[model samples]
Target: MDGTVVTDRTAETVGADGTAGRDALNAAAAASAAEGSRSEALRTLSRVFGYDTFRGEQQAVIDHVVDGGDAVVLMPTGGGKSLCYQIPALVRPGTGVVVSPLIALMQDQVDALRALGVRAGFINSTQDFEERRLVEAEFVAGELDILYLAPERLRMQGTLDLLSRGTVSVFAIDEAHCVAQWGHDFRPDYLALAVLGERWPDVPRIALTATATPATHREITERLGLPEARHFEASFDRPNIQYRIVGKDDPKKQLLRFLREEHEGDAGIVYCLSRNSVEKTAEFLERNGVPAVPYHAGLDGGTRARHQSRFLREEGLVVVATIAFGMGIDKPDVRFVAHLDLPKSVEGYYQETGRAGRDGLPSTAWMAYGLQDVVQQRKLIQSGEGDEAFRRRAASHLDAMLALCETVQCRRAQLLAYFGQEASGQKCGNCDTCLTAPETWDGTVAAQKVLSTVVRLQRERGQKFGTGQIVDILLGRKTAKVIQFDHDQLSVFGIGDDLSEAEWRGVVRQLLAQGLASVEGEYGTLVLTDASATVLGREREVLMRKEPKRPAGRPKSERTAKGERKQAVDLPEEALPVFEALRAWRADQSREQGVPAYVIFHDATLREIALSLPADLTQLAQLPGLGEKKLANYGEAVLKVLADHGRLEAGTALEDDSSSSGAESPSGD
Candidate 1:
């Protein structure tokens, strides 16, 4: 903001002798200023954003981007991806241009930055012409620190010309996975973003995403023309979210039980498969005394915005939504994300469930999946109006999702392996499969019988049968179709008579997952693949675990999420009310200030304040989130809240105060 360092394009030229003398002095001053600004990035991180240090992969990302090098960042949903670009945007000179995908997210990002006293603005269709001109004037005058724009606006010539006139510092492309054709969140506008490399060849460009596979990663770099950019990949694993999949039987009742018993009065998201389901589920929850709202493409924009606003500001608001929501939600305390229907792919499931437990607390990724999901997904993948390659890819992704759902090994390990990271031996004790440790049975004989039946049926009838008919024949059930086909006389028909329907289903699902068998055609006809030969010939053995069944309307007895929980802030029982009061204060302030509550202070910080009960503004400022400006602004109120709570706990045990211990909470495993 100093005027001496400001560059002028039309200034008059000076004499060589005078210029030489001035240039030396200017170079010295610039060197000193650069060093100061480099350090200022760290200072501002604490003073403005209220963080004492950079998180994992954040400081390195900031250093790389601040040094004017391009970077490709792949971090988890709550992994502090914003700070990687934000810190550098502040440390580097000129206004930071961000290409955001959604208008709703643009508003939240601007509000959050403004809350931290950063001069941030956004340009999008939501703004009128006059508003756009005002932001443009401020941007051209270099009064803005960060200006977010929709991808379409960024590709416009007028916007491009405007950027050419100013010292544009950095270009940050959020949700860079949108450029990949095979990704679920693909957007055509992102394809135009490759021009950023050509237009501003010297400006450092950073592409960031919370969801990406190895294939998607390659596509993003190629599309964005960032093949040579520095790369920083934080672990894609969200360990705070405990993965649990239950068989769907009376889903509405099961969902109610989960809410009433485990997560009563906690905020969460219920993802449904259709708009009707979203609306119906919202109504169902409301009828059962749980406050709920619906969100989808069918709802009016005004209604959607209101619902989102309430979900962000209010506590215990359940949003039953289709896949239309939760892409860029900034709410940090979502305790759970429940899937009423199976997601289309593993990437979508991972990204959606990750919206929960962003604060490094124990959260849940629960799903009620069943055979119907597999049928519907298979139909969609097989009969969709796409090319052969696209359909095959869809089938592949669906198969992978099914594998994760039915995997007997660690769910986290299976998921990480899909993204090319191996973790076979590193067990995550949080997931349901890992927690229960189900018993396995030698399924090699069952696999051989099933494969032989498929081969016999194909050889005799010149076609295979669906899973239902195949199961009927295997169980020796003399159904009408079985008798008509004379399948009862086959050698392998009665060989599987000992297994139950559920057990046979498990074996079949495992066969499909392990690539020993495949399903073909619209009827889901069972067909044998190459791997079936090894199993049929006794060269490779097969083992499978029976999938556990869930009670229709009862909650699990484990009290791990909220009760018997392990969170970053461990306050004593006496300090619980004070923590709640601090949260109430934060919510009220967030409403009045029109920003997300975490923008003021995270729940972890409030918990610390309640436990330690800081006596004055000075003690409060010593906390990680209470920086200089915030100390001057809300420090007194925080102190009052803490002082009142301190008196309430004055007779409590004389525990050591640790709200300002200056040690960071360790990240999840």
Candidate 2:
């Protein structure tokens, strides 16, 4: 096999400005392989794999494997990961045995290779005895290029014996992060993969997964017994998706509004926390005239498969499900991913939202976040039979997410910081906070009052308390809980009367976000940490941001358009007509294509086309959201509209400056 070999690099290596590095990697591979007297294999690799050259660090990873070094790859999804191991498999020896976790994915991979005219087969429980025997015979005859295996098969009596009989080209573990208990989806069978080295020491191994924090990374290496494996991680950020967290009083109503106005007729996933919630939410959407189906482990396998197929084949079908629906389901054009409930961790959030906008199209990641969701998720994590340390870490991550929800600052900034990366600007100008522009106040006094109350109560009752009781006592409300505990006698009891119950709740939430407050599991009570001491003593100042209550039955149009809510919309009469026409066109395209209307053309894109009226493909492609693919797909139709209106002639370049820096639409696969 001839091809350029590339190594996987850390995310930092493939920065947002990585085109130059990718080209260099491709060029270097072309040069090195030819000089090694395998110039033919290099060219063959490119031609067969449908790549002109190698991508970032792919060559290095391929070389390590071909040279017989065990490796761990942490490439992001859709980062050309398969080629790294696949190229070496073809060149190394008789048969490359790949251990994969998903049976559905195995079938898809084999089908894809067969489409490319490669001989690939999988031996698993799904195949009958005769079928397995045929595949085994083919493997013994040294005829198969790639053989995919489930880890469960490795334990069979004849499995290791047959493996020892043949030349094992390479042992590749796909979704290798499953080896770690820290991972969202852990599989015990993955632990069996480590035995491959003992069973066949000479065979090189490659383990790969899309999402893994540093902890998962370490676990993958150790559990797989590849202590010295080289590591490669791509950047975790998905810039194409505009992340938004909406504070909702009625999440179902908000979801319906999004579906009608923005995500109508789009294939999307809505994640819920329970099987019952999944069914209820799906039914709610369906009753509202949306095409949605429920998916959970409770549903029969056939129903789940039918719903999944409909979602992939047809546009605009919503699959309301638990997080279980997303693993290995690789539908790339999902327009939106809405969470009816909060995910447990940032890692889970990133992976779940990553399902949308895989086609490099602008996509909406809309989520409704609230306090109860956080509390519920934390309770679930603690309820599990885990060690105290694990529970503490899980609680910490939950607090981080809750803080993200409570922050009136840039959502992108908070999320990026969680991953240890700082965003370029204070405002992403795309999230609900940047859009709504919530109110901010110097909350130092309020924080002090809340902290003091927690401390005073601790001294009085010798117990932890919940938020309701604390807030009631702070606001000087004579609630039964407060009266029963005689919290009224505390020095801080009547001091917080200046703030309303709602206002004090905000203060308490912010305190939690700041890590000054924590929930004690043993007592189901709020406890002040040592960090709260300074604040309570007036040594530190605290500030708070809160959202103004949304007006009842307020129309969305009256709602501000985020960044330019106050900016004047000045338009010429000619431009107004054209803008309406553009909207009409988008609506029609969305209906015909069965994708979200934004998928055809986001509002920003429509504004650009209305102002510029680009006459040809070359100019349209330059506009934001109108990539080469989109231009090729809809170029003629768009230009024809402009031509009919006599706006295509003398195309003038209007100011490209729009309220949004990037076009917001659904793209990615």
Candidate 3:
């Protein structure tokens, strides 16, 4: 949700908030009934879906859709959004048509749904015409409860004709934010789905998006022809995902160090901006003792799918990929996500980082960014074909992302603030900035000089020029660009010599971020927006964080003394004693099984079995980390230890029943 829509589009608020309006009265009545109906719904939800309780606005949104109404749902990444619509589709009378963006996701989702005994099917580009016909027949006869289609297919003539004959219950658009061009992923095909109302007016519609800014929410409702949709906004807080952004310098080394120190044998993904980078990084990591695989658009479909399957099924394997990967992937145990390069916008940044900690365990979001990333992003946007209006909005978004990179404030606070949410924390103490304090300097005069230079340039040149050019003019360096442009004669010239070029760049980046300046893609110019004039007119104060010197060694621990992010062996302290005893017994059992010590019992399941201290096999399966295979194989031995010891606590020990003399094993065992 760390995104916004700052475009020329008009946003309309549909229903009145007062007491007596028809829409409001209807919405209130629906809300009242939802509280009472949850119990009945729960019986059906559990019997059909195997889920007991709703997660984060799921029930409210589902109720809104179920009772013949329109709604726009904004939920976080792992907030169980699919269930909000899926449950209602199951309860509805006719087939529910879901418009999604990805074909692979549709297949996986439908497979999972069918596994639950729901009548689900999908039509996408991957299917042949005959295959498509079979699916269409099933959908037309109401044999399929939920039908998934891409936005493009939803608008196709053949598909529309088929839908016209079938009894459509509701229309749900997944990833609804793609309807707006201002959003990160703007698909032209998505804009065509707005005519669903014109095609079928009576069907209740639901627009679902994982991350939407205020503007995006407005755009989605307006474009999708849902002017009177009820709104359900889930909180954007993901407390489990620890966020950290490091300044660019030896990024590869920092990544290696972080991986070695924290994620020695955990599953994770390292994202890069290019295919070559992905392959190179993956190979380097493998050489350094971590088993890793590279995935990108450059690989053939078969190879890519095979590698992805391996990564998902195996533990402790890292996948280095480009933006092409990790979309809608349901692998929940990804321990960390590392970005080798900075993203173009905060929305893109948030979406990428949100992939970590999906299982609600402790995880890290690490990024390495620099000024070069800013320049490249500006060049890309400038080169894109669009009106000046589009360029300005894109530039503003990029500046906001850059500001996030350079801020001394809490990283989480700045991130949440961009999406118009107030993060109630003075210090997150998880990010690099929060872990180590930065040097702050009063750059009021320097800020004024930079603004004055922009004004002297008549605000014509775009904001893409580096602070070096402006600082040169201010310090009277007489650089060629400044001399040719006659910027050296300005009164602001020679006023910023107290600041170095790197320091000045930081200020310019912050100014752009605060909306004081705008970056122009054409002619690679930098201009000031209306926000900049206010700063120059003394209405806003300018504060900047000086770039901290790269620490000679590792910075002090960002976590607290208790190891806030310390990756322990996933064992409870109360059962550690039993774990030690089992590990020793397993070490001796390895000789009998003719296998390695870990082959007999992994540290992960041993920890779980020990924590449960299961006196019987039935109770052992209920423990946190034990699986069917583990429970079947190690059930008896693990239960024997707990029964013999009768739940030994962390520091206590039990007599060695396996040893004839009943002696305790040494600490190493």
Best by lDDT: 1
Model 3 CA deviation exceeding 4 Å by range: 1-37, 425-437, 444-542, 551-555, 558-655, 658-669
The best-first sequence of candidates by lDDT reads 1, 3, 2
Pairs with backbone N, CA or C atoms under 3 Å apart (clashes), candidate 1? none
Better of 2 and 3 by lDDT: 3
lDDT of 3 by residue, 1-669 (tens): 111221111122233553344554455555556654565566557655544577768888877788778889887777777777777777777899999887766766675565456789999988898988999999989899999998898667988999998988889888888888898878889888877888888887888877778888889888888888899988777777777777666777878888876777778889998898899999999999989999999999888877776665555789999978876666566788998887878888887788776666677888877655665677777788799999889887887888788777888888888778887788876666666766677766677778888777664443245556776876679878888877677677788787777667767766666656656654445677787766778877777777655522225553323332223455555566677787677757755643434344445556666766666777765664343444565668777777666644322433444452435555536
Error of 3 at 110 (Å): 2.5
TM-score of 2: 0.71
Write candidate 2's Cα lDDT for 393-448 as tens digits: 78777777777777778877777677656777888766666665667888888887
The candidate 3 region of ten consecutive residues with least summed lDDT is 1-10
Q: Where is model 2 more than 4 Å wrong at Cα?
A: 1-54, 63-68, 91-93, 406-440, 452-465, 469-503, 520-524, 551-669
What order do candidates take by TM-score, descending? Answer: 1, 3, 2
lDDT of 1 by residue, 1-669 (tens): 344543331123335566744675576566666667667878988888767788889888887788789999999998999888888888888999999887887888887787678899999899999999999999999999999988998668998988887778899999999999899898899999999999889899999998889999999999999978998998888888888887777899989988876777888999999999999999999999999999999999999999998898787799999989998898888988999998989889988998998887778888997765776677677778899999988988888898898777899998888877776366888788777776688899999888888998888768678888878888999999999988888887777878888778778877876778877677777788888899988999898866665463223554535453323245777677888889888888988887778878877778778777788776777677676767787888888876776675764433333422323433321
Off by over 4 Å in 1: 1-35, 422-425, 449-465, 476-497, 520-539, 549-558, 561-569, 646-669
RMSD in Å for candidate 2, one decimal?
11.8
Model 2: per-residue Cα lDDT at residue 36: 59
